[model samples]
Target: MARERLEIEAPEVAVHLDAQDPESLRRLVLEACQRASTVRTDHEPLVDLALSQLVRGTPDDNLARKLEELAERTDDRYLTAQEAADPNWATLFRSARLASALSLALREQTRSSVLNSIYEAAHASPDTAAFYRDLLL
Candidate 1:
């Protein structure tokens, strides 16, 4: 079944998310977060939008690892988006990346409306959810 496109639009930006390939979907999520962050320095909204849309698309182990790696990079100032000419954009990227990593890690346990969409895609069961929950902490 084809996943429905989740359209996120702001005055200067419009992102369409419906890619079937996990890698493409991950790229799209990052692109969307980058674009949204450029428009607004605040990270939560953009990260939430990208992650919510990402869960609706597809899931891949490599993509999950990429998200985790992104989160880890935030600890290194030189490796983070913060070092870019546009420091605000880098901050946005770092924040969004962290949020994405958490979302992927707690995929089965998160209950937010956006996070729930990912559970649907994965069809995670109670045991799976419990496993994720155990890892929480």
Candidate 2:
């Protein structure tokens, strides 16, 4: 038997990475965040596809840097567990947002707690609600 290793690359949603300006960077980052939850709706394959699109190619570096600069970053407990094993950077980011949205939506739906903080996001933001609705069921 022989042993082999492989290196994978990210996809290019757009053309050149650095050629993009600030606004484009913002859009890509937000797209990653929004896309972060949107694909979870269709189930696991879609989640994988979403991650493929999310971190595809060198764009993830730009997307991640933009996300860290403009928005909050997510951490994966599962990936953290896997850290001792596989230690995947991209997978960690991919899983975190999905977990965050699922947890938040579940808490909002199941519990009897703060109305404005949780409820407002569900009620006031049509896009947010639609995204979650589209993601969940």
RMSD of each: 15.5, 17.4
Candidate that would win on lDDT = 1
Measured on C-alpha atoms, candidate 1 has an lDDT of 0.38
Cα deviation of 55, candidate 2, in Å: 20
C-alpha lDDT (0 to 100) for residue 81 of candidate 2 = 51
Q: Count the backbone clashes (under 3 Å) in each candidate.
A: 1, 4
Worst 10 residues of 1 by lDDT: 5-14
lDDT of 2: 0.35
TM-score of each candidate? Answer: 0.29, 0.27
lDDT per residue as tens, model 1, 16-112: 2221344544443333333323322233553455455555654444655554564455445434445566555444444444544444633332223
- Please name the candidate that would achieve the greatest TM-score relative to the true structure: 1
